[model samples]
Target: MNSSVPYLLAILGEGVVPPSTMVCHGDDLGLLRGDGVFDATRIVTTEDGTSRIDHLEEHLSRFARSIAGIDGPTPDMDSWHRLIEDAARNWRVPGEATLKLVYTNGREVVPGPPRGFLIIAPLSETHMEEREGINVLCLSRGVTSDAFADAPWLLGGVKTLSYAVNVAALRYAKSQGADDVIFTSTEGYLLEGPTSGLVVKANDALWTTPTGTTGILSSITVNTVFEAADDNGVKTATRLMRRDEVLRAQGAWLLSSIRGVVPILSIDGHPAPHDDEMTHRLRVWAGFEE
Candidate 1:
């Protein structure tokens, strides 16, 4: 690893440490069974060395909800806050970065408590490129729109560590010459992106998939964007949408914390409508614009 690239790691109870020097047991369920939850938000450091974490409280709330969804004991928010602060202060990078909070059930067979940690790393060029615009492939997620209604085992809405499927979907998109993926339900209802929330504009109104029954992870970025949009007098709604509806909408976007808002230029090799003015508005609303 290059020393010039800033990085920081902090364990739940432990203070910040060299990221490469930290170790986890081989049997930890977080690795062994992909049993864990995480949340990521942006961290920005100004020229004068002042750092601010975007939506920290909201991300922490969602992280706790994910832990509870997985039956893990409630975390000590105060300790997590201190650890995050320590890691951010140690980072010292004066640019855009991602701060992720991770928690996992402890060792598979060992009797122990849950494990938690925070990682702070600089944002990559790809994140910026994607935010400019992206072509996406619509992929079936192999579940009905209402799959999560009564299925606690599904772990829907929880940002779990088991992301093999999502990663595979993105890989599949890349294999198809696309930049990202929009996961649709088996019933053909638009769900969300591999790591983002799907939002579309139709009839001058902004629409996104509903979270509860669709198993869509509640997006902090989307929520923030909508709040800003509301303040700007833009109408917003949440509902199930078909692929065709999205394809024919005035515009489409993938909302995420790290990437902010990324416009979808094409879907399934078909040209989708683009609204430059709305895109700029969304960028400004999401704080992507200075």
Candidate 2:
């Protein structure tokens, strides 16, 4: 690994790692019961002497919303903003790159001020793929939309660090020999992937599960693609996506902040037809193509 790259991981809580240049400590609650939330955004730099935060404000707003219900050990917004800005300034690469920001409820334990603050990780360009896509496998035993609507204990939409379930879902997918998993509701409506957004093209329209019903995080890439789809003559809609319909769609793509947009080649061991036109349009909309 190149020593020029700056990596910082800060722990907010007492009796943690030494407050050194790399790992810092704090007294926050995110470490105990995983009560905090976070959001990650990418940093894009062009050849025209310009640096742009692809979706900075939107991501921060989502972070704020994730922590709205918590009453104690809340994150400090002023400090959080400063840290992100500092991370952006730390960018030394010339082309496009990624910036990851995390904030958790800060307290020594569950009942004190939140224990996790913010940590920014800089991602180099080589860490990402230029033209690759994702392969997804569906899990039948996980939380469905109906289950989350009724129970609400899973906290499906929030970006909390207690992501054990999500990791488990992905691992289960890997066990089945796939890159990721798309969760479904008991009623057969599509929800989302563990870390990415679900999107499909059918009848000249772009569709995803409505945020209200699916309890999936409002994906920034999905929003941007739909906004730009109309100019390319693609219709857009969001509804309860039935599993059968998704399996039969013309094409599918998983959108995320870091990966940008990746097409789906297979689902549940079934090969999905690749539509070059749609992929080109989406890549263009996402700044990956002209």
Report lDDT (CA) for all predictions. Answer: 0.90, 0.68
Q: Judge candidate 2 at residue 250 and give its lDDT.
A: 88
Q: Give Cα distance to truth, residue 9, candidate 2, Å.
A: 5.2
Clashes of 2: 24
Candidate 1, residue 150: how far the Cα is off, in Å: 1.0
Tell me model 1's lDDT, rounded to 2 decimals: 0.90
Q: What are the runs in model 2 whose C-alpha is more than 4 Å off?
A: 1-27, 45-51, 72-78, 108-112, 115-131, 148-156
Predicted structure 2, TM vs. truth: 0.82
lDDT of each residue in 57-131, candidate 2, tens digit only: 788777777776344344566666665665555444556555555555545633544444444445545236523
Find the candidate with the highest TM-score and give its number.
1
For 1-290, candidate 1 gives per-residue lDDT tens digits of 67877788888887887778654788888989989999999999987667899989999999999999999998999998889887877777788999989999988887888899888888988887888899999999999999999888999899999999999999999998999999989989889998999889999999989998888999988898899888989899998998788888899999999999899999999998889898888888888885
TM-scores of the candidates in the order shown: 0.97, 0.82
Per-residue lDDT, model 2, residue 69, is 38
